[model samples]
Target: MRNLLPLRSALAPTTTVAAFAATAAVTAGFVTAFAAPVAVTAAPAVKLVAADAETNVAAVATDGTTIRYEGLSVRIPAAGEGVQAAAQSTSGDLSITVSRSADGSVVVKTDKHEHSVAQAASASTSRANSAKTCTDSAYQLAGWKLPSFTWYYNPAGTPAALSGTASSAITTATNALSTACGQRALGLATTNGGQTTAVPQVGTTGNCIGNDGRNVIGWVAGNGKWLGMTCTYYKTVNGNKTVTGTDTALNTQYKFFTSTANCSGAYDLQSVVLHERGHSLGLNHVDQTAHASAVMTPALSACSVGKRTLGLGDFQGLVAMYGTK
Candidate 1:
């Protein structure tokens, strides 16, 4: 069973801060499906401190908890969740979910079935045992949905040496979600708010929770094990959870390729953005072992451009949440 817990700002001494909303990041872990293999490493242990009373910083406990900074609230997974845990936190009507990926193996794709990177190692063995199918239709909701929101981009955070059309690629990736689910279902504005110098309120060391009352996407430079993280802020309205704000940060330590034709060992930018956008739009990671074809799966491969497109389960999940077109 999944757990939904409300977190209090460690900075608040007496009163619970309700004005700020929650944040989440969809950290990426990569694997390769081609020939040369990428080394898989474990994510570093998160260290937390109060810093100062005004910092709103808090530590993640053994059972997962909330961390806050002023009006910014974030939820980090416990010790055992690793990168696989899909954590969701609720504070009154506001809630957040952080979806992360784990170190993956090669995802196998055959005529009969496709295996997620997380399950690729065992796929061959399973295939030998019995015929596998790619018909797994499974997805989970984040308990919230955005009726409509216009997001902005921060080109200042773009990698200094990135090639290809980064901005256009990101815009296309963001729109891919609504395209998959149909506009009537997810109603995201076709136009963005343009680029801005303002950065996402997420940090490199701890939880990705921060609420600045804007939907922004940018990059963060760090050695964190995850590829990208999406922080979505939502509040309950009339008994329904509605998204109010969001911020997404892509780790600069890893190399990303916008054009698959130029892709070497780098991960696909559109694929990563597609996955994060799914989280931003209120979709959680389905069991990758069960739904490998899903864009909502927690694992991805280096050149899996196919992920740029949503699977049957991904479409169904969105329709289920926002309603059918």
Candidate 2:
């Protein structure tokens, strides 16, 4: 089953504080002949503190050179200079500029724009409502640099008639994701990892859970409700965030259509594999009824073959996370 978990990516903060400058006012009264003219110098620069009491910082780099607070990540590009920060949200992307002052402090500023209360309310409502529904977008595996996957072939537990076709379907799904990412996202390889014990009888488990990071793909009997499952695990590697591995399992108990077209009552092998691959590639279910056409939709009705091809939104999400080749 496709998990409905929220896709939480580190975003740069949207709020900003402008540099404060004090204006000097000169009195209009005529100066006495003996009075010397007063020269006015610019106000002193505003000092930036290393931290603020009210700011909610999410994650900070160990070296203190990078700080992620309120969806914004501020990076000190160079010492004794300035910082660059960026943020992205459904509304749009925001960029923040940080300048060093003469007083050895930093000043942060953002582009001025009107934020309506209606927009904030709408966003809040959408978030609240989406807590239970599937997401409309995809998320990248956190801290992943050059992310890729390797799936081990396992046909021992699979149905004999469908084995070859199933393996081919896995390859097709891998290629689809790679094409969407505009880079190689998954590959085939050999490994000695044992079969996963994560499969739960359909009614026995409410949510899919288990070991990840081996990049293994195989078959197992499932309780009828789910056709396939994928679990991805994450870790930090040498200060870079990355997905350690993903395990994809198909239900051997269910009848699947191995042929390319027109299997009246059976599920499409490629369709299920494609959906599971999306999960392994850091995509959550787009379960909303409005997004039913998306390949990432949580539920797949039997005999539905349309999902074998990527939907527009699904493709956009892939491009959003991984740039074009």
Candidate 3:
């Protein structure tokens, strides 16, 4: 049953961008590999707190481990042999307490101000449902087939110039996608359908597909809510979901930084492209905020360069779609 999955985004918007039939499934996220356990004596009560005006609030343990969520960072101290005192912030309604679980995992509890507890509970449930919806939608291309793709610096009918940074970024993204799935399904080509389609002009739409069967990659201004998008056109031929073509467009409207040092207020180009390429390879967004560390996570955090590499869930999704070597 090969069907077109709806266009998914890196971030959820107030309104839907495109509509399509829904599918049902559950997916998991990256799990940290714990090393051998070590016994230690009870340490002193520790507390640390920090906040960001724009994106997140965070709290740090005495050892410097941190956890942040919902634009707020609550404070948690290093867990001794047992539970410790709760920490609260003066400015916000956030409070956190730390305790050791039966299985030896550290547990942290958070609470809003007494008045907003009900509202906070409702909002938390809503976010959890949204994340579940995303986790359930780890999409894969039909028949487990991998398609060969080529990139165009210049395609017919448009005049977008490819900067050195952009070109390198695309190459890196393609290579990462290819290597991540352990498949040789993508490559670079000099021409498409015998036509020398020089990289089309920036902001040109609808130039990548039609006539040429090759998948095309380039940049465009993603209007409104999209940071990047991939249109993977596939059809059911002879009971197989065969891909016809794919076109990837990066949002030129957002600031893309080539260098990590300059990544403040912008996204990492390779990270964004790597995610878009996942779409081209028949993988859909893993919308769960808990899996935000996954490469296929629907939305990217500002200045986050972590998605350049595949997480456990991202790799598992690719393997499920394509197969392991």
Instruction: Name the top TM-score candidate.
Output: 1
User: Candidate 3: how many backbone clashes?
Assistant: 21
Top of the candidates by lDDT:
1
lDDT of 3 by residue, 193-244 (tens): 3223533221222112221445566555434334454544444345444455
Q: Report the Cα RMSD per candidate.
A: 14.8, 19.9, 23.0
Error of 3 at 112 (Å): 28
Candidate 2 residues lying further than 4 Å off, grouped into runs, are: 1-146, 180-212, 236-241, 260-262
Using Cα atoms with residue i matched to residue i, what is each candidate's TM-score against the true structure?
0.60, 0.48, 0.47
Model 1, span 292-322: residue lDDT tens: 5667665566555667767656666676766
Q: Rank order by TM-score, top first?
A: 1, 2, 3
Candidate 1, poorest ten consecutive residues by summed lDDT? 104-113
Q: Give the 10-residue window scoring lowest on summed lDDT in candidate 2.
A: 116-125
Candidate 1: list runs displaced more than 4 Å. 1-136, 181-190
Error of 2 at 142 (Å): 8.5
lDDT of candidate 3? Answer: 0.40
